[model samples]
Target: MKKTLRNTILGLTVTALFISGTLCGCGKKAPPIPASRLDFLEIEVAEQEKYIQEAEAKYLEERAKLEAANDSKGVRLLDTMNRERLRNEKQILKKQQKELEKLRQSEANKK
Candidate 1:
């Protein structure tokens, strides 16, 4: 009788938790950002794009100078460094873009 009672209590507790979880909703949507915040994000993304372009141009110019000097080792080192920098910058840009997109999506959903 004690074993049966324990099993019944466990089952009841599990069912109650399930019902509460379902009612509470697992994925709550975030509130939309304000228009000014959206604008700021847009500006940030644009600045990031510009920065990436400038970095690429600078890298190309430096690479050309190294090639002209015939410093193969220096050229290789520069290539490695520039590639890592660009990769990091691009990742940041991607993150900013994603945030902007999410904000836009939330704003649209709010309407």
Candidate 2:
């Protein structure tokens, strides 16, 4: 009977130690996810960059074509349209650039 009581006390002491050890912060935390794996904004930024490049290229091509053509009503109309497109595209590019910056800022905040 004495042996049994000793063993029970020993077991309880071991369990208590274990519980206290676990309650004490072990200095272990889940590692932060790798930024490259977590980041989805990069893809969108790249796509927007491509779109901006293509728009600028098309505008330049149209301007060159206009410059080569003799001044006529149709040419004037096309130039006006091209100018509007350029303005609109520039606005879109600026907006997208701002969005890209915001995404970058948010990504940095996660670090």
Candidate 3:
């Protein structure tokens, strides 16, 4: 009987102390920080800076690929135009040669 009574009193005392400590806010909760004490802008700036850097990198890579494709297209166009020009020049030269030959034949007939 004495052992059980002593255990009961000890349990009650522990319960009372727990209740008092909880009401006193004796647990480890940090105090609320004032807005001026927080570095919210700094944290946001860092994240935005990271996002901007990634965006720039992506833009540069895409622009490089686009420019390379455009350069290839330009080269192919120039080649096609140059081939057309050469063909026209060849045709004009042949016509001029034929006219010269006709004049020579006429001069021989007159002699």
Candidate 4:
């Protein structure tokens, strides 16, 4: 019984070491990032910013037009658009709050 227990413990220790060695051996070298890809990412980000600005401008312009119109359909459509904009704004505010909370928690952890 003593021999059997010793063998079992030894086998587990050996198995654990083997697994750790195997895991450590599997770290592969990362490929270098290309300069051209970095440039492409910058260009894409600029384009996206431009597109978002354009979209916001268009929505604001449409909203003003809706507000100016006094017709029933215009009023209904404006109300719908306003509701949607409010909903989207609420979601954005919530997401910003969450990000702020995460930043605060991380800063606290650092301190």
lDDT of each: 0.86, 0.68, 0.59, 0.63
Clash count (model 3, backbone only): 0
Give one digit per residue, the lDDT tens place, for model 3 in 26-93. 67444344353124443444555565566556655655675778876755665566558556655554
Backbone clash pairs for candidate 3 read none
Question: Candidate 3 local accuracy as lDDT?
Answer: 0.59
- The number of the candidate with the highest lDDT is 1
Candidate 2 backbone clash number: 0
Candidate 2 residue-wise lDDT at 80: 85
Q: Write the per-residue lDDT of candidate 2 for residues 29-106, one digit (tens) a residue.
A: 433343662254455556667876887788677766767785467567877887797688677767766776887788
- The per-prediction tally of clashing pairs is 0, 0, 0, 0
Tens digits of lDDT, candidate 4, 1-111? 999999999999877765556434455433334355334444444555565567667767776776777466876776687668757765665555565566557767979
Q: Which tens-of-lDDT digit does each residue in 1-111 have in candidate 1?
A: 999999999999877766555433564433344368789899889989999999899999999999999989999999999999999999998999999999999999999
Q: Give the TM-score ranking, best first.
A: 1, 2, 4, 3
lDDT at position 30, candidate 3: 40
| Candidate 3, residue 93: lDDT | 49
Model 4 RMSD vs true structure:
15.7
